[model samples]
Target: MRLAKYLSHCGVCSRRQASRLIEAAEVTVNGHPANHIDHVTEADHILVSGQLVEGPAPKQLYMYHKPVGIDCKLRPDDPSSLSHYLPPGERVYPIGRLDKDSHGLLLLTNDGELCNRLIHPKHHQEKEYRVVVDRPFDAQFCDRMSAGVPVDGVITQACRVEPVAADTFTIVLRQGLNRQIRKMARYCGYRVVDLYRVRIANLKLDPQVLPAGHFQPIAMTELKLEEEEK
Candidate 1:
């Protein structure tokens, strides 16, 4: 794997952070300053900031029910950051982001490859959400949202939108644009009152079992990503 990917797989930091470390000359491979393009094998020795970096550790995944106000970014000094809620001694990072204003299922994992796979736009990973609008909307609203809505000068991909109530609907999206659901609703002349993610791929959030602000370890088998087409 590339040097950055190797560092990420070792749970040292994210691939992007790893790149910065390499650029700052904090990483070394076989006693030489590491290059970003360098690849590693079992025979190579690697170190970060003078600490030997062993091969990747066992991967771990967690299903966290992120609260509405908690920031997804890992900020040790920030009490409201996701780092405050993570398990002690584990260096896992959130797979994708759920904005602080919205809350629901969020996956945290130490497996860098899996994280990249799930969040990459080409994967078309399905994410489902339950949204409540400020005012009642009709079938036309759903049709407009399902067909597509322009966001930031780009048209969003077709998605599944189903109205559950006069002012509430469920939507499934393959794209993960920034605050996408909210933007779509606003474009259709409806303001979102509340938004909650319900599912990501095969993983579903059961509020009763894993209530808000709680999390639990999830097995790799539970994801079943192999069944998904690339």
Candidate 2:
């Protein structure tokens, strides 16, 4: 039987957390609450949330250039979306989310394993963006953001904020928090005029490539890096 190790291999969670989930009765075997923490092999039927646990899907990956005024992500309340913007195929979820008001490079994939690995807090995938604010940039604001900014009672992770123009900067983050740049700008007394993600890991969107509402297949090299992260 495949043990909880299989879950870790699938990047569902770290091995330690996987064991805890197993013990906490969050797993199932043949539609029954699977109480055992051992033997997670394929010999036994295993699932989490009614979905098969270890089998792989036909991995599909794409890079979508999200444009401003268009939400690249799916939301129940938002009446429009980029889902209709993608080429026809199996459904894919964003590897990490970008605010609808902000546009940039977004990765969509059906590989849940890589998605789990990339989004998991510990993996620390680097997300880089180009930000334009209405007000002039200040050195002090960059310093504060790089150190840490208090938001929602939690200090955000250290970031690499580099000035690209008098009114623009490149913000690189290891942590993907919801509307983090917008919140950071507000805290810094700047109005975010335009924002776009330029890079995720080694996958860089080509210069002015893939216009808004359009997507293209991603390279296998990028997928390999995500799969191997511990």
Candidate 3:
């Protein structure tokens, strides 16, 4: 595999970050600084910043109940980064992001391929959210949002929306755009006061069991991604 890909498989860093590390001479293969496009094999000795690089780790997945204030992006200087809540020494990253202001079920995994599959727009994975807008809205508002509203210069995909109350509703979307629910509501003259994801594909967030700021190991079988193509 290419050195960057190998590094990503090893749970060291992302492929892009691996390239930056290689450019900075932080990685060595067989005692020589690694080239950006170098291929790696079992026989090659690799070191990343004096730490030996080993074979890829077994894949791991977790269901985390993300809190509103936590940032999804991992940054060394950010104390509230998602990394801080994860188990020490596990290099898993979130499959998709929930903006800092929104919170709910977020998946973290070490399997890069699975991450790509879950987040890719072509997959059409269902994501359900419970939302509360600042003011009461009528059936027309729900109809407008369900039909598809313009957000970020593109019409959002038709989605299922059910009103639970004048100010609250549930929606299930097949596409994930940045702050999509908030932007969509804004376009329809409503402001989202609260947004919480309740489900992703077959995985559902049970607040009583896994409350905010807590996480638990989840089996890949629960996701049922392998059955999608069958």
Candidate 4:
């Protein structure tokens, strides 16, 4: 593959952006500097500028219950931070993100391809959240959220919203839009008292063992599903 294409596939950036970085003389191949948009092989030593251009690391997956107040960054700028609270060593990024104020089950991984597939707008993987609101819940509101609310320019996909209590509801969504739940609630004039994501596809929090601000390794076999009928 061309060096720029290789960089793009590795989640570095797009081919054009890679070319710009290369032309800026910030990229290198092996120990030597690189300046041209040449084809590069897996065996070739490549780098952006002085840093070595090794391929992205092998994919890794973990489940973490992110507590409120922590930003979803691999390297947080805050000295007193929750990511800093993670075990030291290899860098892992969140597969998707949960807003800083929300708490829930979050997946952390280095697998860019899997991350892209799960988060890319098309798949619409299912996610479940337990939400607490400031006032009593309404069946009508639940119906509207399930029926899809128009926000921005598009309508939300029809979803599953069931009341679990007088003041809370369990919402299952297949979309990952930014602050989507909050936006939908705003449309209905509900103030969320608490928001916690409880499920992602085949994985759900262990009600018996899981807790906030901790993590557990996930088995690859669970995710290694064979291709099947769509």
Candidate 5:
């Protein structure tokens, strides 16, 4: 395969971005600067920015209950990062992100294609959250949220909003904007005190089985994800 395509398969970046990296003279093949966008066979050695770009690592997918205060960045050196919580030497990235303040089921994996599929808005993957707010929850709050509310100049898409208590509700969103649920609540004149994502796509967080800061390997078939490496 072409070097850029191989880089994409390594989860480095898309082929276009890989080409840009190559153009910048950041890629090397067999310890020498690579000048051509050439094909790389199994016998050839490739590197990008000093990092080896070999065959894809073993594909792994984990259901992680990210506790509050841990940021969803793949920084192994940062003690507060989600990567710090994983088993040692297991390099993976979050499929999508949960802000530092939020907690719950986050999918982490080495499979870039699966991550792209799940995070792409076109898939309409459902993400459900349990939210606690400062104001008393009312039908109007549910209606406005269900109908869609303006957040950062863009109105949110229609979603399922079910009241769970006087001050809490369960929300299901097909779209993920930045701090989406929190922003939506603030737009509706409420302040979120706590936000917990309980589900993503077809998987739900079973707290009793997988508690906070804990993780478990889940079969790709459980997520209905194909095993294609790239």
Candidate 6:
């Protein structure tokens, strides 16, 4: 496995962070400073910051209801980072991201391969959100949004949009553009007052089960995933 993937499987950090650690000369393989981002073996001894890492840790996944104001990055040095909320010493990376101002169901996992597959837009994983706008939205807004909306110089793929209230609505999107829903609303002349995610893929957020800022383990068997053919 690559050094970064090995570090991630060891529950030490994400692949990106692992690369940074390697570039800073904080990692060593077999008692020698490691410089390459690739090439690591299960038999090779690994060390980070002068501490030995035994081997890959057990794979785990959790569904977390992230809170607003928490940056969705894994920076232990930053107190406000979302990774700080995870169990102490259990390093996991968010599959995608939610900006600091938006909160909802965020997936965390140590399985780097699964994380990559889930976030790839080609999978067309459905993400549902509850939105509140500053002003009342008519049926026309839902129609336009469901048809398609221009954002970031491209036409957004058609999504399911339904009005919940005069100022509230629900939307499901498969594309994870940067601040997508907010940008779509803005283009339609509406200002979003609040946005919360409620679902991702097959996982649905049950507030009574896991409230905001809380998380729980999810079984792989619960999700029927197709294994890629070699």
Report the number of the highest-TM-score candidate. 1
Per-candidate Cα lDDT values, in order, are: 0.90, 0.73, 0.88, 0.76, 0.82, 0.84
Tell me the tens digit of each residue's lDDT in model 1 across 1-230. Answer: 88898888887766877898899999999999999999997579998889888788889999999989999988878989999999777878898899899999999888877887788787888899999999999999999999999998899999999999989999999998999999999999989989999999999999999999998998998996634573
Between prediction 3 and prediction 6, the one with superior lDDT is: 3
Put down candidate 6 lDDT per residue, 1-230, tens digits, no spaces.
88988887786766666788999999999888887655887888899998887787788888989999999876769999986798556767788999899988998888766775666666777889999999997899999988988999999999999998999999999889999999999999998888999988778889899999898999865544434435
* Tens-place lDDT digits, model 2, residues 17-118: 557777888878766776644565656677765566655445677998877776655554566676666558555657767777888788887655566667
* Candidate 3: clashing pairs of residues: none
- Model 2 stretches astray by more than 4 angstroms: 1-55, 72-78, 223-230
Q: How much is 77 displaced in model 3, in angstroms?
A: 1.0
Give the winner by TM-score: 1 or 4.
1
TM-score of 5: 0.84
Listed in order, each prediction's TM-score against the native is 0.88, 0.73, 0.86, 0.79, 0.84, 0.84
lDDT of 5 by residue, 129-179 (tens): 999999797798899999998888888999999998999999999888999
Cα lDDT of candidate 4 equals 0.76
Model 4, span 1-230: residue lDDT tens: 77776775564544555677888887777766665657777788877645565676555678888889888754467853556866456455677788888998888765555666666666777889999888996789899989999877789999999999998899998888888998888889898879999988878887467688888878755653223226
Candidate 2 displacement at residue 185 in angstroms: 1.6
Over 4 Å off, model 3: 13-38, 45-52, 226-230
User: Which pairs of residues collide in model 4?
Assistant: 26-48, 26-49, 27-48, 27-49, 30-45, 46-53
Ranking by lDDT: 1, 3, 6, 5, 4, 2
Cα lDDT tens digits for candidate 3, 1-230: 99988887777766666788899999999999999889998679999989998778888889999999999988757998887888677878888889899999999888766776787777888999999999999999999999999999999999999999989999999888999999999999999999999999889999999999998988887886523443
Give the range of the ten consecutive residues with the poorest summed lDDT in model 5.
221-230
Q: Comparing 3 and 4 by TM-score, which wins?
A: 3
